[model samples]
Target: MPVSSENKNGPYKPQPIKKVSTTTVVNPGFFAYTNLTGCQPYYCAEQVHLINNITVTALTIIIRVQKTSAATYHGVANNFWTGYINSNHTDNGSQIIYTFVLDPTQTVVASTTWYVEAQMDLYGTSQVTSADTYTVSVTGGGITNSYSGHF
Candidate 1:
């Protein structure tokens, strides 16, 4: 039997846009010397800027590391070490784009920075080291828009 229009619920729900950021560091004892014995940390955060209208479901972060020096030691170390990303934010069934660990063989001259982007299934809202800044990009509904900001 057909139901009355008044008994029907609202329209289908859509996913929200999410904000994300990334950072990089070159500590004195960490990723600076030959021992390759130090550590660097990455951070990502998300919040609901709007009301209870939207909810976030997934997020992904992408980081890129570039070496400035062509020195043999630096080149060798770059391939030897790995990079990684750490976040306290809970996952809502989203896949992480990429994560890398720091390389210890790279020289001090090497310049490194991380680029992070996130996607949320439900309108949500929104760091750095080694003299670097965080760049954030949000993607979702509402004309399929995109925005970039620094922090």
Candidate 2:
């Protein structure tokens, strides 16, 4: 038997429609470095900006160190640090972008910043040495994050 049209208890009911809007933001990336002796300490810092999108709530910053010089005695070690910036709203993974730190530890002090120096020579022919520092600051609207690196 067919149900009466006056029945208020319908199996299928329609719901109200909803509307949504979206916008995208872009960020900038940069890098810088200095030369020094093997034993000397060095320090450098730079400011980076992180742009947030609707999907990402935070941005992760990763710092990596590479030996641009082939001095054999100068190899990079202990080269990784992590920091983050927040987006105004939640966002997908793709919305997050990374800005690397040049030096996070502040290990390289003034005058002592050297490219190469002689060691006690306990194990190998020579020991390689390097140092780095890093810091993160957010502008407009975002979370605060920071990390350091030494190598």
Candidate 3:
């Protein structure tokens, strides 16, 4: 179902649109992410975000999750893909990338909203959740930038 943006920090801001094609435009201007808190502490428990895409061309999004600490599973679960891993070897801190293609034929409208989420879990017998610094970069055809958050 189409949803609205619920990212606390705001939509991922494009540092400089110059890097991407001049025709590109970013919506919401904030990157949505969740830093693991005591309330929702879980390993690889990705956070959810409703991406609001308002543009002329279809949007292609790439979500990258970066973990600085050792973790059993670290990846991004988003609207485009689930449990995506770039490397076969996964453990103790990593960078996972996931992609989503919004074609013009799809029900997702150009000026509508969509959902995207991400999370990472550590290997342990018990739930050891803490605010770990992670950077999420959303890259598209003519748009690209990163946001720093915790999870």
Which predicted model would earn the best TM-score?
A: 3
lDDT of 1 by residue, 1-151 (tens): 1111121124323233232223322112111101111112222321111111212111122222111111011111122113432332222232222222222232212233222222222112111212212222222222112212221
Better of 2 and 3 by lDDT: 3
Please list the residue runs of candidate 3 whose C-alpha ends up more than 4 Å from where it truly belongs after superposition. Answer: 1-41, 44-57, 72-93, 103-107, 124-151
Tens-digit lDDT track for model 2 on 1-151? 1212221223322221111112312122211122222232232211222222222222233332222222122222212222221112111322211233233322221211111111111122222324222223212123233323333
Q: Candidate 1 or 3, higher lDDT?
A: 3
Q: What local distance difference test score does each model get?
A: 0.21, 0.23, 0.40
Report the number of the highest-lDDT candidate: 3
Q: Which candidate would rank higher by TM-score, 1 or 2?
A: 1
Each prediction's RMSD to truth: 21.9, 25.2, 7.1
Candidate 3 lowest-lDDT run of ten: 81-90
Q: Please list the residue runs of candidate 1 whose C-alpha ends up more than 4 Å from where it truly belongs after superposition.
A: 1-54, 57-60, 69-137, 140-143, 149-151
Please say which candidate is ahead in lDDT: 1 or 2: 2
What is the TM-score of each predicted model, taking all chains together? Answer: 0.19, 0.18, 0.42
User: TM-score of the candidate numbered 2?
Assistant: 0.18
**Regions of candidate 2 where Cα sits further than 4 Å from its true position:** 1-41, 53-55, 69-151
